[model samples]
Target: MRPVVFPHWFHRIRFRCKVCHAELGFKMRAGANQIKMTDIIDGRFCGACHDGETAWSVENCDLCHSGKAGLPPGIFGGHETLGPGRW
Candidate 1:
């Protein structure tokens, strides 16, 4: 399966950081939470807003899973970086 290319900038424009970090329990950093499909299906994590009411449902796999195969899973298309030679 392709890694989900999460558009953090998109969400940041619509919601505050606390909305997901404090309220929904997502960590400030990527890969900090061990997200599972079962948890989302059970209405946890992304499912909280993506239940087809607040946002699109998980049934749309292409929306999120748009990253190329072999790419690391995490937030994408942002300016946040660890500087040159960090990786």
Candidate 2:
């Protein structure tokens, strides 16, 4: 199964940064949070809103987990670094 390709830019257009970063308590740093399907199913993280009402339900596997397979993990489309100026 392909990993979920989280359309950050797409979500950014609909909601503000605080929606996920602040209110949801998501870390600003990429790959900072170790997300799990169980947590989301329990109404945490993405589940906070994606419970079929605010957003799509997690049952829709293909919806989110659509990333290409065999890709190196750790924030796709961006460079994985230690921190500011640590790259």
TM-score of each: 0.84, 0.77
Candidate number of the best lDDT? 1
Candidate 2 residue lDDT tens string, 14-71: 7777999999888987778888899899998889999999888988998887777975
lDDT score of model 2?
Answer: 0.75
- TM-score of model number 1: 0.84
RMSD of each: 4.7, 5.2
Residue 62 of model 2: what lDDT?
A: 85
Per-residue lDDT of 82 in model 1: 44
Error of 1 at 33 (Å): 1.7
Question: Which tens-of-lDDT digit does each residue in 1-87 have in candidate 1?
Answer: 898878887887688879889998898777788888787888888989989898899898888888889987778645285423455
Q: Which stretches in model 1 have alpha-carbon errors above 4 Å? A: 79-87
